[model samples]
Target: AQTVTQSQPEMSVQEAETVTLSCTYDTSESDYYLFWYKQPPSRQMILVIRQEAYKQQNATENRFSVNFQKAAKSFSLKISDSQLGDAAMYFCAYSKDSNYQLIWGAGTKLIIKP
Candidate 1:
């Protein structure tokens, strides 16, 4: 069984600063994918970053990057130049090769301080 764990329940960062959200997962499968999804007040799950288990390089998108430690089974999201729009509930998820069923974390609420 695979499980995602988010130790932080809530996090706050000043606008224009940076913040990192922690995530860890347990899985026996060798081939899988890790993802960080952000759900805003609108309740839409938006993909922040994705990391393939087979890839050694971390994944990044604009100001968002992931520190994917395959050996430690940890995938943390780092938001650079945080903005108010970045404030949301972040969820760490895992999916086996082509499996649509995502094992999700409890979620971390990110608050952007003005």
Candidate 2:
């Protein structure tokens, strides 16, 4: 069984600063996809970033990026210059195919301090 774990239940960062949310997963498959999703107050799941296990390079989108360590089974999200809008529940997920079915982690609520 594949599972994702987020050690931090909550994280805080000052506006204009950077914050990293830690996530780890256990999987037997060699090839898989990892994703970071953010759900704001409106309850909309937004794709932050994604990483392919077979790829050596990390994935990034705008101020969002991921440190994907396939060997360690760790995928952490880094949000640069975080704004008030970045305050949301961030979830880490693992999938074998596309975003159809995903094994998700206990999300971390991000607090942005002004």
The Cα local distance difference test for each model comes to: 0.95, 0.95
Question: Residue 6 deviation, candidate 2, in Å?
Answer: 0.5
TM-scores vs. true structure, each candidate: 0.96, 0.96
lDDT of 2 by residue, 1-114 (tens): 889999999999999999999999998888999999999999999988888888999998999999999889999999999999999999999998775489999999999999
Writing each residue's lDDT as its tens digit, candidate 1 over 8-37 gives 999999999999999999998888999999
Could you tell me the lDDT of residue 13 within candidate 2? Answer: 98
The positional error of residue 55 in candidate 2, measured at the CA in angstroms, is 1.1
Off by over 4 Å in 2: none
